[model samples]
Target: MKLIRYGEPGHERIGVQINEVNYDVSAFGGDYDESFFASNGLARLDEFVKANAGNLIAIAEEERIAAPFTRPSKIVCIGLNYKDHAEETGATIPAEPIIFMKSTTALAGPNDQVMIPRNSKKTDWEVEFGIVIGKKASYVDESEALNYVAGYVLHNDVSEREFQIERGGTWDKGKGCDTFAPMGPVLTTADEIPDINQVGLWLKVNGKLYQNGNTSNLIFSVPFIVSYVSQFMTLLPGDVISTGTPAGVGLGFNPPIYLQAGDIIELGADYLGTQRQEVIAFQKN
Candidate 1:
């Protein structure tokens, strides 16, 4: 099952995507948030789709696409989880997972414009795979981690190098800017993916390929990451965990390239679907 939200930003309605066409399922009486997932929402949603059959209304072709689900309680990220990415950025292999939190307010629709924060010149892009939790998880065993997962998503881990590295105490300063976390044209349920560990992930800017990598290259596996994170804090239903990106971020370049107004970023992962966002200059009030 592929879940989606579509409407006018904050006014979005719940929907389902089947074979590329989206259909209205607002009658299900739930948003894809923590409350909905904690109560077996996915299973109930699947039943609803099965029972509704042809009665589900088809969304108009011109309707806007929002995030697949409502904002999660948190967006936790793993840094330097990929070998090539670690090497490219001049970092050593970590003895433990490097964790960071991105502000929830940074969430934006997949196709929305990415705002270049005012006074910024080091804004960059990272294409990564994201995990959505289905139930409360705390101190979970690595072997049992997958049981708590609801779905997977495509994430663009947009960043500002200056605020993150040079000017900073922590990466969050650069990571939590408005429009920095563009995610999901669709959220594919765990069952849809054949082998989650072997997924292909890629990214392009202005039609030029920049990131070409695979999940198979990850230094730490998904279950380990989930288990490791759960040990420190409870991961609630609807919370997202971005696995980390492979090599080819702008920060990895010889002189380092950065995003500017009018640039376009497109990214996707196997079975998770794709996203496209235009870069727009920030405006002050």
Candidate 2:
């Protein structure tokens, strides 16, 4: 199922896509958050959809589409997980995953504008595949990791190069800016995808193609990341694990390129859906 939430920024209603039309599931009484997915809510959601098949309300054409889930407990990111990307940045491949976190406040709907923080000029775009955990997972085995995944979504890991590399700290500062993580047009359940590893993923800035790559190029695959991350930190339902970006990032360019105001970023994965975000400079009151 392509589970979705749609409406204004903070008031999205839970829904699912059927025959390309959104079927309202708000009557199920909760946004698609951690609690909902953890308590076997997806099964209940499926039942509801089946029972109310013909009665479901069709979402209006004007309503906005928000991130599929609300309030995820964590947004963990893997850095330099792709071989081409690691080589482009001139960084050695890590023995293990390079993990980082983005604040939940950074989360926004797929089409939301990416607000460049005041005085910032290095904002960048990273198109990645995000994993949504289905249940509490700790000390999970790589072989069993995919079993705990509820679905996948398209994520833009917006970054600030100077703040990330020259500011003398973790990547969080460059990553956690508001609207930096534009999540989805929809969250596709695991059953919808047969092979998660080979999806075609790419991104564009303005109208030119920038990052063009496939998940098949990932050095450390999704299951490895989930199992590896869980050994140290427990992963809760609705927690997001972004599987890192591929090559062709602005940082990987000859002279390097960065986002400025009025830039448009668009990205998508094979089955997860597509999203577009406009970049706007921040203005203080």
Q: Point to the candidate with the largest TM-score.
A: 1
**TM per prediction:** 0.99, 0.98
Model 2, backbone clash pairs (residues 3+ apart or across chains), number: 0
lDDT string, candidate 1, 1-285, tens digits: 999999897799999999999999999997999999899999999999999998999999789899998989999999999999999999999989999999898899999899999889999999999999999999999999999999999999999999999995999999999999988989999999998889999999999999999999989899999999999999999999999999999999999999999999999889988999999999763
Q: Report lDDT per candidate.
A: 0.94, 0.91
After the best TM-score superposition of candidate 2, give how far the Cα of residue 73 lies from its true spot, in angstroms. Answer: 0.8
Candidate 2 lDDT tens digits, 71-108:
79999999999999999999999899999999999999
Off by over 4 Å in 1: none
Could you tell me the TM-score of candidate 1?
Answer: 0.99
